[model samples]
Target: MSKLLVKLVVNALFTVPLLLYLSNATPFQALMASLSLSILAFFLGDQWILDEFGNAAATLADGLLAALFVGAMGTAYHWGLSWSALAVIAVVTAAVEFGYHLLLRRWDVRWYS
Candidate 1:
């Protein structure tokens, strides 16, 4: 699938649920925040993933970025402080990513190696 399409679909899927569950704000606010963050994540994350992964980086990046964006948005919205939310998101994302890498290493999957 095209990267743009993947981003759109993933963003919607991620954002909708987060907005529904975490944010006390209106749906539009949640949607807007989610969309904006998702876009930023897609752009930055695509490059990071490509540099880290390879040919399959697009797919991996899409999923990772979507998760990170949604998590960040939810954390921020729930906390009602931009800085705190960002910090939580970054910490959580790093932990999750590290855990994923560790899992891959333990499985001896050469993909991340």
Candidate 2:
């Protein structure tokens, strides 16, 4: 749980700022997007995919997921976000996620096991 919280915070730190800068998301919208991405990434990328596929694959999955998620959100909300902007957000978030995965491995959290 605590580890998940850390993931959420780290993801939010990167994602919220990018959302605000790259899209027309308000503060609340940005926060919600960040939180939603964080949780989804935690469960899907971190827990399931990481355990099975390791860091590199999980990182890639997370990045793609972020791009799809943000792109969808942008469309739904009329945020005027471009594909290039979504790519930037995904890359940055993936970089952060890579380091975070390293940290998790180093710390040996292994909650599921």
Q: Against the hidden reference, what TM-scores do the models get?
A: 0.46, 0.94
Q: List the residue pairs that clash in candidate 2.
A: none
- Deviation in Å, model 1, residue 105 alpha carbon: 19
Best by TM-score: 2
Which residue ranges in model 1 land beyond 4 Å of their true spot?
A: 52-113
- Name the top lDDT candidate: 2
TM-score (C-alpha) between model 1 and the true structure: 0.46
Q: Poorest 10 consecutive residues of model 1 by lDDT? A: 95-104
Model 1 sits at a Cα RMSD from the real structure of 7.6
Error of 2 at 20 (Å): 0.5
How much is the lDDT of residue 7 in candidate 1? 53
C-alpha local distance difference test of each model = 0.52, 0.92
Alpha carbon deviation, residue 45, candidate 1 (Å): 0.5
Lowest summed lDDT across 10 adjacent residues in model 2 is found at: 104-113
Q: Tens digit of lDDT per residue, candidate 1, span 1-113?
A: 25545555555565555455544657877678766865665466544564476434544454556456655655666634344444444444444334443433445445555
